[model samples]
Target: MFDMENTTVLDRPMLDELVPSRYALKIGEIDVLVISDGVLPLPTTMLAHNAEPAVREAWLNDMYLPKDAFDWALNVMVARSGGRTILIDAGLGLDPDLQLPRAGQLMKRLEAAGVNLGSVTDLVLTHMHMDHIGGLLVDGVKRQLRPDLQIHVSAAEVEFWRSPDFSRTAMPPGFPDALRATANHFMEEYGSHLRTFESSHEVAPGVVVRRTGGHTPGHSVVRLASGGEGLTFAGDAVFAVGFEQPNWHNGFEHDPEEAARVRIDLLRELAESGEMLVATHLPFPSVCRVAAEGEVFRWVPVFWDY
Candidate 1:
């Protein structure tokens, strides 16, 4: 008997338990599912380097989050349209040095959802950040994926990783090195599968990826439109704290200033258009709409579809 709901993978005791790891919904004609890649517990300081300690602390306290560190959600998406199945971002695989053990749950969760890697026709990377590409580098992932898999990413993103700049950004020790190494490894192993794009490219009907170049020189976002509904899968272009403090700088940003500009522009556009938004680091399922409230925007999570 194939009881996918009860089947377990990777032998992770916690993963054996039944939990809400996947959410399914439709964007007009396309099928979309947001899977939880678990969470990454990062230092609170990473939330905003430019913010005053007092002001940042006040925001944290108001949100009831711990002052030291908090868990950041890692969300991955799978979209199907026009006979093409696309993976938006690969979740973190194994990063022993980063000490983030909980976040690499994407592969297992996808398996439980009956999503076979071999069926993925295209992979659209928002950027080459480890959290977004590491899962593909996992030991046996390549073997399971089809040899002709077409990976779509911004040419700027592929070029920036050659000599990534970390001077302007702030991150914990060892992160820069780990990120660089993982990206290098990924490129070396999968570069042949890449299909670089300049600014934007359409992968499938109503599914398009556009370069934003803020979070990373190659960072991009995926937009899906079909029938009359629409949605955008923002890859690290926005965060949980971004809604309240849009100007705050994230430690992981390669170019914080440009990143802020990109964030504001995307939020404003979504707010005005009234389209659904999903982001990598936002809450699970991450299905929400942006509300323009004077200066800062507001996040209005879609009422649970179920």
Candidate 2:
């Protein structure tokens, strides 16, 4: 039995899950909690559209991953700084059309972790992707949240979703439609409450979110610095394969070329700074650092501190 009853898991009653769903760490004086929204299984082709089938298969085989679809880790973050609670990127809510039941666990997991929606003073979205903002659309979630919740997102992101261009993307048959509809719905529900920014904004002391459009027109990444420690919650700007193959284009990128450029730049920057990183679709608790070896980069997951 995987019992956490006598563990340091925030002292909440966990259900269904046998392992910890949240990982807590600190940066300076800021409190950071990396929560597992859950794993989203998607087709392998979606990972690298620009690479040849043989090369992609070889990489997957080297990692011991299946040749077919695999689970992509969906992670979100909660930050406490300046006496404010901030939620970064909500997780994938229920999507009957997507048939992805493994995801959308954020709501329940958050509650189990002793996080109350009403306590979230601010929300920062990296972009308006359905998976990133879907948790808000979950029934009754809105009612549970505080009325004056400030949702910070880039102005460019909101405008792009108005008539999102999927022509450049390489999503599955129904993916584009689902993304479009979900983004539209998210705006419909939370548009009026959005706190739009142009380039960068300090949501709270020691926490900054900056636009780094690549995967999406308004893609953004959040950075936290305090007490000489820094960490970046790199939304979709980086991925599991991003470090090793920064040039490979993910199928979800609207402008894959720009996305590749963005990935390469960000990886190089992180490698130099040695700041920690956590991405949306990286493995759960994707707390890792970037290491450079000449042209390519490496992913060094931080040792778990349970």
What TM-score would each prediction reach against the true structure? 0.95, 0.95
Per-residue CA lDDT of candidate 1, range 271-300, in tens? 999999999999898999999999999999
Residue 37 displacement (Å), model 1: 0.7
Provide the overall lDDT of each model, using Cα atoms, as 2-decimal numbers.
0.92, 0.89
**What TM value does model 1 have?**
0.95
Question: lDDT per residue, candidate 2, 1-306, as tens digits?
Answer: 112243244445454578768888889899888899888888998889889999999999988998889999999999999989999999999877778888899988877766889999999999888899999999999999999999999999999998889888888788888898999899889888899999999999999999999899899999999998899999998888778888888989988999989888888999999999999998889999999999889999999986
Model 2, TM vs. native: 0.95
Residue 270's lDDT within candidate 1 is 98
Q: Looking at candidate 2, what is the lDDT of residue 106?
A: 94
**Deviation from native of the Cα of residue 27 in model 2, angstroms:** 0.4
Best by lDDT: 1
Give, for candidate 2, the lowest lDDT window spanning 10 residues.
1-10
